[model samples]
Target: MTTPSGPTVPFALARFATDAGSVPGLVVGDRIRPLSPAELGAPSLNEFLAAGEAAWDRIAALAAVASDASHSDGTTADAAWRPLEAVTLLAPVEPRQVLQTGANYRTHVIDLVAAGRAKDDPRPIEELREWAAELMDRRAREGIPYFFIGLPACVVGAEEVLELPDYSEQHDWELELAVVIGSPAFRVSREDAMAHVAGYTIVNDITTRDLVFRQDMKDIGTDWYRAKNAPGFLPTGPFLVPARHIADPGDLRLTLTLNGETMQDATTGDLLFDIPALIAAASETMPLLPGDLLLTGSPAGNGIAHGRLLRDGDVMVGTIEGLGSQVVRAAAARVPA
Candidate 1:
């Protein structure tokens, strides 16, 4: 339905292993709004999304009123109305847990080391030390160094803008491919791991760049988690498109623009570890459940280290080839005067 602000759409709220259902929703001027859960034949918000694509049709019907306005190019005549900004964009999935990979892009690694943030060898220092003696004996080999983690509170949604806290000065932005789990999977084979995927969306893994590098030493738990999990660290979506539609996860054209200048531009192929490898490696340990999220990491050329950290009123927009785009405003953590 259309609100005084603009046309709206039924935005879905997804969950796993729970009775929550999708709620009726509308996109009122740049925001995704829930119409009413009960009206969609579901008891709870998560339950409605769990109903699957069929429910999406019904949810789309909720937007029928707005969509019928006879406009060109999937937009309406109201220049001031942007449905994506009006409603509170909730994380589409209720991930039992969230897992992310570090330094998965080959070019990103090269650039990182050039920037003096990462070591040249992907192997950990301890492993390097162990292999040093063996190298003298002529049997040393290099290996990929990967870091994985379960970031519980590092979740937010499409419409929400992140607040950079005062205590931190080194804020950063990472544009990643966020995968939503569709089924329960554990130690799944590469071919099968993708079957567990629910869909894909964009993720801006906002990081505290200074904190990331300050605690860059080995074996010690840097307060990176706290800095990483700060409120609004992760902002995702405009919507989640089913995997069936994305023919090649590795070929998508991705771009990140800060304020208005393009800051990062690269394809998913730049990834050192492709999507399947990441899925297989992650599932080897934790049981990935439907709605669980995985962030595929970002590429080279981000703010913070590469450029200037984001500032108040700075607008960051992330766009993927097929997937829709999302915009975030960088405002000081205070009520605008």
Candidate 2:
């Protein structure tokens, strides 16, 4: 119900995770200080997000000061706040529901179908486009929007392990730009959608392609969370760059690295649905809360299309130009056989 305010924050910002050791960080006045657990005092980003706009503004102000001082002389002070590593990167917002879109990117759709990763179902595409156009128009008039959900437990932060489950051999990685809701939004208009966004982060919507398509064909209930929620399946975050800091979400660069090789690279402009549409579609179902996260679909070059599955010890990295990035490692799940 609260009107969203601008971030009023700058880049070169990050919330330190208290649980991660070695809190050493670059201080406000261009000084690098080793942070002991006691010296590190900021709550987790998830906590700060829950604190609402007033607290967000304060946090933004402090980050802005530090960001400004870091680049005081035109030299970029690029230091990763160790504290971010300590906290388990929860979903940007703790939304009661999480919604993701399908075929939101043209290339993602075309490439998947061409590679036999997705079915050549023109009917679904036609329905979705019409649905999207209608939703877009509806959002222009009213404040309510449509959106979807991802499983809550399907989230993991930077440097975390993505354990590929033993049930399937079709694990895939999707590089997506995730939007975190800052304020309460219900039936929110597109003009107001961005206002409700607190910031942006990176998400790897890891999935089991074979399982998903097979389930989709049966007309049964969705198997999305089941295939996507394997332990450590959702690798997110190294930082959450407040929305104000980003000049334009559409203009940002998105890239993903598997092991040391770069696999996917694109931008938000390539999104078929875009952020505003996704927001509108989502708000139609439920009120997007402070911590709700909306993941814009990924770009071309997924592992599935190329037949490359992750192995133990593979490192995965995802980055969005202004929003910082995340690094996740992969390994076999440790289960008692």
* C-alpha TM-scores of all predictions: 0.72, 0.73
Q: Give me the overall lDDT of model 1.
A: 0.65
In the range 1-337, model 2's lDDT, one tens digit per residue, is 1111112224323333345542323223222223333322344434445555575566545556556655446344544433332344433334445567666665656666556523555556556555555554454455432234577667655556677777777788898888887667798877877878777777888987767744436767446656676766667654556676677887778788887688998877766666877787788777878767787777888998678977777777777786555777777778831
Q: On a 0 to 1 TM-score scale, where does candidate 2 land against the true structure?
A: 0.73
lDDT (tens digit, per residue) of candidate 1 on 174-236 = 899888876677999888877777578778888876666345564664455755877778886
Model 2 spans > 4 angstroms off: 1-9, 12-56, 64-96, 117-148, 215-217
lDDT per model, in order? 0.65, 0.62
Q: TM-score of predicted model 1?
A: 0.72
Cα lDDT, model 1, residue 142: 47
